[model samples]
Target: MAKKKSTRRPRARPEAADAPPESANVAQDFANLHVWQIQAFRDILLVAAIVALVWAGYALRAVTVPLLVALLLAYLFEPLIARLSQHPRVSRPTAILGLLGTVGVVVVLLIALTLPTMVRQTTQLVTDLRDERVLARLVELQEAATSQVDRLLGVFSKDETTPDGPETPVTGESDEESAPDGPIPGEPEAGTTGPPVPNGPAVMTEEQVRDLIDERIARERARVAEAEEGGAWWFTPGTGRVARGGWQAISRMIGAVVGIGLMTFLIPFYFFFFSLWYHDVLEFFGRLIPESKRPRTLELLQKMDFVVAGFVRGRIVISLIMGLMLAIGWMICGVPSALVVGLVVGIFCAVPYLGVVGIPLAVGLLVLEQLGLPEAERMGWLWVVLWPTVVFVIVQLIEGWVLTPLIAGKATNLDPVTVLVAVLAGGSVLGIYGMLLAIPLAACGKILLTEVVLPKVNAWTRGEARDPLPLN
Candidate 1:
């Protein structure tokens, strides 16, 4: 055997040439790497991957939003679909299709029932904004605010005035400005400087802020009105026929139509197939994990999924209940656009207490109605602003103390501050989509951390070995 050791290594097997490289299991290539090295590498890769995914998501948000919407709709309708599937005559696909058809019909009925009235009331709102009485009320509000500010300023100022007359807010006027011949009582002259009187029309008056807001709003409203007034057009050069606003409007319209078309085409496409293959999708994702960890992965996934689904569905139900409350309250209060405002506010109720921000507009409409009534009728109408404030307070109490606690709070199990901060951060980063998604995403994250992540981390800390990183 020593003699046979003569310079000959064993021949490689034929199958060896066809064998996959160690790199095929990429982790295997690094099998001999130091633990710290491997950890560093993985950490860097993970950060890079997250960055790439975020960039991709931002770039693909056009398709992404529709896809997400479809996913949400699927989630919303899944229970119903499942229930229907259990019936003798129905299968999953049939159930999905049937439910979608029912949704469509309901949507159509809703539009038919509400659109014309909403349009009429909306027009009335616009016209009312310019009404003399409304303008007078607005002026009265402005004066009241100004007077209140004046009083506030007076508390920090020294005033010398006629005993019979009301004390007015002192200004930064030099005595020379008020009385050129002599220094006004308690006021300094141009030549002499006393302690600076903190004054001058209360810089940036509340009324001024209101005026600025009103001006900006008016400009936007005028622009929209102009667009509506001259919206249609026949023909023109270059663009050949175009919208009333010309090429710009035509382009916008075209873009809008394309977006609508894509949304219409994609949502149903996604929902239909997803509804049919949801379990398959789950399996596909599940199989990405190693056989050993699949059980744990699946368990964790189910928990997160349950949390998200409950939060989403519970939130929607809560919104509906809140909307109903507002609708009934508004109808009883005889608020104009009661249905439209209540529903609009209600549907937006998913974002914690964000919905109540719209109450001022509702209040304004109610105030207008109250003022329009005769004197005797107006007497019974609560103070112009108080009715809306009361309504808002009551609705908020119902939402906070009843609907939310019974529904969304239970669904998410997130404290108010956490939910609010998440919503705000999400809104800052991604606008409406972020706001809508924040709480559910947070819920999922909490579950993931507690169920999936922590368990594995604890196992490692306890010196339990891992094979191919558990997730495979």
Candidate 2:
């Protein structure tokens, strides 16, 4: 009876006996894990991502452009939509239509104002290029540059030959033989050597210098002509009456115009409906998830929405403010095409860090162009020395101390260095469109990863059975 009681007392439940061993094995495996498999998996994912990105770039160019345009337009007008939504009498569709109409009118007015000037300027530029006088002037410039360079080289070469010494003549046999002997030809007597022949340096004759310059000019002109003749096809216009090349260029231009117009036309339509129904769509889709994970999914979506909305709204505000400031500044400086330059700056400002670098550069170039060739040459050095430095300093100061803080705020939580790198990488991958989308996409990705992924990983590390809720 005592032996039977002891055998029963030593027995343990199967679940209880297996639990600790299972967990211990899991811990041991985690501790002794080889990361090569994980790393390989990551590498495979990276390669797949890259391939997908490249394929999407080529395959979805049309859809992508319009979608991006619509997204941006929607973001810009979201505030208006929200405000209009609160109106007692205005329907959402009506409000959206009103905003779209306003945007369209504004855009149309801008194009009307700009197109005439742009066309005139472009035609004038082409005409100027074809003008024989302009070509001659360009040739003259090349000659002048070449001559100046040659003169600089000659001066340096001559300086190299002149030994560093006091103004003393070396006693050479030629000098000794040619020495004056009682009023020799072209020489005064020792007491009166005609101001000692102005002993600082010997000047080359004007005729000889001119001849050297002419030779250098001729060589430069030949080089320039040769290069021009062999230049890219774009630089050379059609040679015959067969307008194939001309038609091709025109067709390309038209295609670009049409593409932009289509983007502009379609974006508002998509944005309006998309914004109106986005919440419903999201909720509907979210319901498919298991009840256990729905809360986390909703939280992730909320964070993503907040991040995207904040960034987009912030960029629009910043771009508008920058455009206003540029217009005002250009007008104050009496710069030509102030409105156009301001508009350009505003458009570019929609981009992040590139705007910071590009706006001042564009303004400086406009200032230089307005100064004209002769004025630019005469006072160009002053502008080259002063204008860019002043403008860039001012722009950076405004961006750092005022605009960026006011618009983007601490919500982005992104460093300037990070923003710049993202923009550059995006630009390299997808050109201008990529650059435009990069920062916002990066911000969204940051929000998703930090609020969604990290919490799960943390819970897993703690041997938790369930994932933790994402941070708001």
Residue 255, candidate 1: alpha-carbon lDDT: 100
Error of 2 at 169 (Å): 7.8
Instruction: For each candidate in the order shown, give its overall lDDT on alpha carbons.
Output: 0.78, 0.71
Who wins the TM-score comparison? Answer: 1
Which candidate achieves the best lDDT against the true structure?
1
Off by over 4 Å in 2: 1-60, 112-238, 257-261, 288-290, 327-338, 356-380, 448-472
Span of ten consecutive residues with least summed lDDT in model 2: 233-242
- In the range 90-119, model 2's lDDT, one tens digit per residue, is 978888888878878998997798789766
Q: Where does the lowest 10-residue lDDT sum fall in candidate 1?
A: 232-241
Model 1 lDDT tens row, 1-472: 4565568788999898889887776767677677657778789888999999988987999978888888778877878888899999998888988888898899889889989988997788778877777887766656767998999888656443335576667776865477557555546657887775554554788789989998998997676667667863222232354344587877899999999999988998899988888878778977889999888778877787777888788778988887777877877777888877888888888777678675787777777676667658763434556765677679889877887667755766778888889899889999987998898888888887876678888888788846435674
lDDT of 2: 0.71
